[model samples]
Target: MTRKQRVLFLCRDNATLSILAEALLRELDGLHFDAFSAGLEPADRVHAAALGELRHGFSSLDLLNPKSWLEFTSEWAPEMDFVVTLCDESARVDVRAFHGTPKLRHWTLTPSAHGATHAIENAFWQILKRVEDFIAAERRPWPSSLKLPAVASCTTDACDLLLSGQ
Candidate 1:
């Protein structure tokens, strides 16, 4: 059997965007992907608003927790197939390379300027859209030459559509 592709999502704080992406991908395609999330500097707990948004879509959230990216630096950590940064801050943080040399992609999503709960709710939908698009792209056949570019290095709007594997 083909091995599941492992993906890690990173952000400044593992409170909202990264958490949502991890849960959405895991619930949507656990058979094909192993999803994980960590922050450069993790919060003490998952944000309450994040948990509330997740409750609407996920029944089993026992595993969700805010953790440091340092946790994945250990030899015991699974080799990631992809490392995705959800925010600009995370994409800029200098860090040691992942063991597996995973493809790096940045999905530039910012929480809405609205109040906390509304912001988390908005981020949930945005992340869910990207998560679903990512899954669909992963399932399609692609030529080896068309592998995803290092989107984290791309600082322009031109790279936005690349997330859809277009």
Candidate 2:
């Protein structure tokens, strides 16, 4: 069997978008990836709204915590195949600490989008959808199947998760 790819999702705070991206990617397809998240400057505490949104949907996600990008500089951090920035602030900053060799992608997930309790939930759902979409696009599209296989796209749990926030 082929080894799974390691993907890191980064944001300024690690309190919201990056956390959602990492968890959602694993939830969508654990067999294909090892997801990680970190922030340029981690908050002492994770944003409550972020955890609330996730807990209400996924039954298990112990990795949902704030972490500093600094930690990834050490030898312990997993080698990343892809590094994605989920916020504009993080996307603009240099991330040479990972030896500057990994592939990178950017998605705009502004803090402004999660301004309230309901919006916070919506933001999580949005990030989840975006990450799933990113994975689908990255895979070699089957020639006969110009569209990604529905089974491999959004799953029922994802639908429930997104709808739960509504």
Record all residue pairs in model 1 with backbone atoms less than 3 Å apart, i.e. clashing. Answer: none
Cα lDDT for residue 74, candidate 1? 83
- Residue 83 of model 2: what lDDT? 88
| lDDT, candidates in the order shown | 0.83, 0.77
Q: lDDT score of model 2?
A: 0.77
Residue 68 displacement in candidate 1 (angstroms):
0.6
lDDT of 1: 0.83
Name the weakest run of 10 consecutive residues (lDDT summed) in model 2: 140-149
Indicate which candidate wins on lDDT.
1
Weakest ten-residue segment in model 1 by summed lDDT:
140-149
Candidate number of the best TM-score:
1
Model 2 TM-score relative to the real fold: 0.74
